[model samples]
Target: MNQQPLSIPADTQASLLDVLREQLHLTGTKKGCDHEQCGACTVHIDGQTALSSLTIAHMVTDKKITTIEGLAMGEQIHPMQEGFIA
Candidate 1:
């Protein structure tokens, strides 16, 4: 969640999900349908939810991206992981 802004290479040509999984090694965002139907690869951008599989990596450099890890606080479990353990 405290991740720094990403810099997408100009030559990059992949979906946000690809950048996250392949480049950033963020496997928290899952790919279900790959057709933008299932909500598996869900992430937040600027406090809003978006489908990472459909988003372009280069187009999100200016946005605030929050993955499942972002919702976790040291001792606090993320809601999606364990239904909001406080």
Candidate 2:
């Protein structure tokens, strides 16, 4: 996990998923469909499930975006992750 907050260009027209993967190199969220139909791009935005692919990067500047990569704390796994395993 990154200790510092990511700073994306205000003028960037990339999708939230693109910036998360291409810029920050956080690729845990996969791109299934560019459309919002698939759950592969599902992530938490302020604790609510959202489709990253359908979200604009500039619009989420002040929001807390949580990708799959952000769920774990070093060696500790999140409860949701453990549930998926079980």
Top candidate, metric TM-score: 1
What is candidate 2's lDDT per residue for 1-86, written digit by digit as tens?
13456667734678888888888888878899887777888888877888988888888776788888788888999886686568
Query: Whole-model Cα lDDT per candidate?
Result: 0.79, 0.79
Candidate 1 per-residue C-alpha lDDT over 13-62 given as tens digits, one digit per residue, 9 for 90 to 100: 68888888877788878888988788889999989999998888878777
TM-score list, all predictions: 0.82, 0.79
Model 2: CA > 4 A from native: 1-4, 79-86
Among all windows of 10 consecutive residues in model 1, the one with the lowest summed lDDT is: 1-10
Please give the lDDT score at residue 46 for candidate 2. 73
